[model samples]
Target: MSAKYNHWHKSRHSDPNGDCVEVAKGSGGTIGVRDSKAGTPDIVLELSRTEWAHLLTRLRNV
Candidate 1:
């Protein structure tokens, strides 16, 4: 599962010591998303590049 993404990084606005989300570049034009807090189950969500951009846009508008 770890091999699915190259590298994972949280957003710049993320709290360093609190629950955070991480994203990584996946194979092809995919994006990988997961939670980085301790004790959280290792779950990953894969999205296409277009879907990722759309999600970001919607988030920014909220």
Candidate 2:
């Protein structure tokens, strides 16, 4: 199944009204993220598999 089904949502750190970034797990195993306010060609950020793992680990302890 496409890993996009497992979304990588952005944190609600400061934004209270849900105006935050966008994140999703791509089928290619990398983590896909973008600015929710971006338009046209979205500024997508792709994280490596290893990078994604480390990020999750760090966030888990935060």
- Candidate 2: misplaced stretches above 4 Å? 1-8, 55-62
> After aligning candidate 2 to the native by TM-score, how far in Å is the CA of 11 from where it should be?
1.7
Superposed on all Cα atoms, the candidates' RMSDs to the truth, in angstroms, are 2.5, 4.5
lDDT of 2 at 29: 75
Q: Which ten residues in a row have the lowest lDDT in candidate 1?
A: 35-44
lDDT at residue 27 of model 1 (Cα atoms): 70
Per-model TM-score versus the true fold: 0.77, 0.55
Query: What is the Cα-based TM-score of model 1?
Result: 0.77
Q: Which pairs clash (backbone N, Cα, C closer than 3 Å) in model 1? A: none
Least lDDT summed over 10 consecutive residues: which range in candidate 2?
A: 1-10
Computed on alpha carbons, the lDDT of every model, listed in order, comes to: 0.80, 0.69
Judged by TM-score, which candidate is best? 1
What tens digits encode model 2's per-residue C-alpha lDDT throughout 1-62? 32442555776663776567767778787777676667632467788789878987998999
Per-residue lDDT tens digits for candidate 1, residues 1-62, read 44368778887878868678889987766888887765653677889889999999999999
Any runs in candidate 1 off by more than 4 Å, and if so which?
A: 1-3, 38-41
